[model samples]
Target: MSADAFIAAGPRPPRAGAVATTATYAWRGLLKVRHVPEQLIDVTIGPILLLVMFTYVFGGAISGTTGDYLQFLLPGILVMGVLLTSVASGVILQADRAAGVVDRFRSLPSWRAAPLVGAVVADSVRYLATAAVILVTGLLLGFDAGGGLLGVLAAALLVTVFAFALSWLFTTLGLVVRGASAVQGIGMMAIFLLVFVSNVFVDPATLPAAVAAFVDVNPVSHLVTAVRTLLAGDPAGADVALALAEAAAVTAVFAPLTARLYGRP
Candidate 1:
């Protein structure tokens, strides 16, 4: 059926109808993934390459042995995978906006929040796929999760939740940016800054005292630390709390901002 027929603009839709509208838009996003499997390249290839190259190539240099490094690096790689995929939500939204897809949806009588919400929700699918690739690659590379299966799964879910929250930040950036390429560039720069400056690749204490303080405060570092702590079967303690707080703060700030900006004429 045609989009017009699928979403006939008439009376204002009931509030409850928002669920159906959001689901439809979410399905549309998923269909795009199905048709353009090329879109999966970043999520699939990036994690594998990072996991392999980092664990084998740089791992020994950084940690004195490949085996010890793999254990430490796998958790960070999982977080890296999730962080990298968070940009998908914004890039997709920007493309849709540039193509007038969002404009067309705005004309419908559906829920105002449906388009943004659905697009970000669809990105959670990408986040999950990347997380899986990282997990499997880490395992094959002899990275054992000290916390076992349950710990690994829990860590994946936590990273996905954090990624879901960060998606709103990038989605807002997409709305602010002019083009899809610019959105992707800006998103990557932000991710790069967060990851490199964090404890993802190195021990924060090994850095200068000033840089180390920032690493201690960086939300990404907190997240990686949480994953490490969980996988080690140790108490996550403050790292988990800090990571979750950061996620909540990011979502709270950006969700409203993205919704407002996207709703603007």
Candidate 2:
């Protein structure tokens, strides 16, 4: 067809819907993983090593038995694994910005937020991978899921939701930070503080009064408790509600901020 005829071939197909655009970008993110399989290390090796080391090195002193500590520790390790993995969302975004991929994304005729939102959505796979590795390793170590398979699934869902929300917060940080390394450094530091200060490795009751007060309200603590409750076969408690609420609140605050700052130079 002549150039004129092609130009006159009527309007191009309608722009993709939000879901379609987002899914396309999400697929693009997954393609990156296929090409660079090393990206799987953080979600796989890192979490497994953490679960094993923490369980063996400190388990006996803390819980009197490796088996008992494994039960208490598995939920927290699951949360920590996924939460730490969530930092990659921002690091990847920062890397994309450096590579000019985000600029190219701006020129595409797709949902404006798709690249940003889709990055987080794609990172969900990493979150799930992290959770799976931890769960499998815990089971191998004789960590019983008192709450059964259904409870295990529920706990995974809750952790994913919390990780998704936290991804947005890190997304915002990615935009504000200048370099991928900077984002990773700052993000990991913050995550370490949050995990250590919470009830992950130790009981808040053993913490200093002021620190315990903070741990009581730390969203990480709430999330870990919710996971523990589900895995323990206990009725869903207020912590479950609090965890969801906190996740919603985080997404509400940071998603828009991420959208706002997304394409800026």
Candidate 3:
């Protein structure tokens, strides 16, 4: 047969399947976490060190009372913990790309969105683990969750959801970038800017007027405030809603973009 006839005679690749593909990718991601358990060390240790150092060293200087400081600082650390943990999503994506795991998956007859969606879902476990470490450490340091167990759990779930949304954004960045190292650098820079520029360690009003304005509007600040309010049993109607809205908006915007980019060479 002629080349054209041979091309026409062959079957076309299968259309993307949704449920099975997403589940398979999600399982693969969970397996990766199991194999690389050491990755949890940073998440666990970082919060502890930050809590110890800030409460002992800078706590008195900043808040004049370590007890009050722990309450204030722990919430910011919780936000930071989740944000920092989300950076791993980008690194893992870059690694998968470099190792050709993504290419191997792409060659299969599965859903195009599976790998992207599954990665985010799997990484959520890590977010939950990190948040737990932060909370336990905060409790040891005399931080109270006046909002009670349910509220604390709700705050944690909120952070996990936010982290999942962040994973989508970073995954897209990893797909667009050439190397894992470059992606790591970019991810670190973004996290630092988000954490440091917000009301993480100090009140935004204490910062310069321009800086304060930016921090007030920063989504991280709102998230931190919301978590703190929940923990303190304070009303968090608008702030919690805003944080959820932001996470939803981010996921809605980036999840499809990452899937499209992942499907491409």
Candidate 4:
């Protein structure tokens, strides 16, 4: 009677598919922000502050007009905003590991990488939100997009892709790092170095030789340049290609590493 009754329950509902498990974990990631709304401050409010402060405080000094500076600054801000938000991938993952949440996921009869991949997928929404908020703010402050709607969408798509790749790198960091704060600190330092060393705030041509060399090679610079070119209606084929390649390389390298580390007992 017991065996027949169990068999009639339909093979334990055939375990969730990969997509279903991934989406469920992704939704779990979003629910964390719903309960703690302040988690979005870095992506939303932080970018707005940076946009306004940088555009107003140094805009006249650098570009001679806040209006003109806004044009140049907005795209860079998008890159910075989304990349910075990506750091949370590592921090939150580390927190989950410490809290035994990840261990629980490991015990489930689902894809092993779903929790990791889904966390990054959920953060992709935060990246898009950051891009949208910053873009809207830039427009309100008199920034214009010459590349039109299609270009803007392309730029947002590129930034999200790059941010997704970068999140994998941070997710690897989460797997290896002993504490959430350590992951956060390292991730922030890494991002700050990338942003500041790139051509985000200045032209590489104007910088000194050694610094300019580094800026010329910075992936963030390529991403910002691609975004700017898209916004300005210019041919960004080469820039976009290079930026995408960089993103692909990051994902190719760290995704496997994260999987390997996450699989460890």
Evaluated with TM-score, which candidate comes out highest?
2
Candidate 4 residue-wise lDDT, 132-178, digit = tens: 99888988888899999888889999999999999999999998989
Give a tens-digit lDDT track for model 3, residues 24-69: 7889988976898787787789878877887888889999999988
Quote the positional error of residue 11 for candidate 4 in Å.
Answer: 4.6
lDDT of every model, 2 decimals: 0.89, 0.92, 0.88, 0.92
Stretches of candidate 2 above 4 Å error? none
Give stretches of model 1 more than 4 Å off. 1-16
TM-score of 2: 0.97
Measured with C-alpha atoms, the lDDT of residue 101 in candidate 4 is 90
Candidate 1 — what's its lDDT? Answer: 0.89
Residue 214 lDDT (model 2): 94
- Candidate 3 yields a Cα-based lDDT of 0.88
Worst 10 residues of 1 by lDDT: 7-16
- Say what the RMSD of model 2 is: 1.2
TM per candidate comes to 0.93, 0.97, 0.91, 0.96
Candidate 1, residues 1-265, lDDT tens digits: the string is: 7878767755655564888888888888899989999999989997899888888899789999999999888898899888989997888888889899889989988899998898888889898899988998888878878888988888988999999999999999889999989999999998999899998888887999999998888889989999999888888878788888999999999999999999987
Root-mean-square deviation (CA) per prediction: 3.7, 1.2, 4.7, 1.6
Name the runs in model 3 displaced over 4 angstroms.
1-17
Comparing 3 and 4 by TM-score, which wins? 4
